[model samples]
Target: MVTAALALCVRTGAGAVIAATVFLTVLSVTLGGSVLADTPLWLPAMPAWPLTATGARLPVALVLGALLLTVSTGLAHRELSRAASR
Candidate 1:
């Protein structure tokens, strides 16, 4: 959700861009264990895991969520800017 929201909010008014970004993120995550798909590693720094393990998924999600929240909060202009938009 954070990824989707961030991508959609920051891109150049291109809805397809965000959709593609999320689609690629999910697709790459599934095809983990490769050199390119290193977002979510299942192993302990040896190979990519891609949210297959709870240990990897939990921490990644936590940190990513925190980072996204911080960015949106910092960039938002109004109180409702980050929470809601047209």
Candidate 2:
């Protein structure tokens, strides 16, 4: 949904979104793994976390999804308004 909003409302290309998503996911996993492994990180417990703790990731995901949804709704609303005026 986030990617769709970026592609549609923000006018980003699908290919660009795919490429960026792949890159970011790889980067996130690498950094997160490094942090979890206790390697020398600029910020300990970073890059990787919703957290390694038990039962703590869902709320973060939910909040972030809600925020993204809100923004997407606003964009969609604006788009609809523009279409209506035309």
Give me the displacement of residue 43 in model 1, in angstroms: 11
Q: In every candidate, how many clashes are there?
A: 3, 1
Name the lDDT of candidate 2. Answer: 0.54
RMSD of 2: 5.6
Local distance difference test values of all predictions, in order: 0.51, 0.54
Tens digit per residue, CA lDDT, model 2, 1-86? 56344636445456766776676567667755654434333123323445432255546555755776788777767765666687
| Each prediction's RMSD to truth | 6.5, 5.6
- Candidate 2, which ten residues in sequence have the lowest lDDT sum? 38-47
TM-score of each candidate structure, all chains considered together: 0.37, 0.45
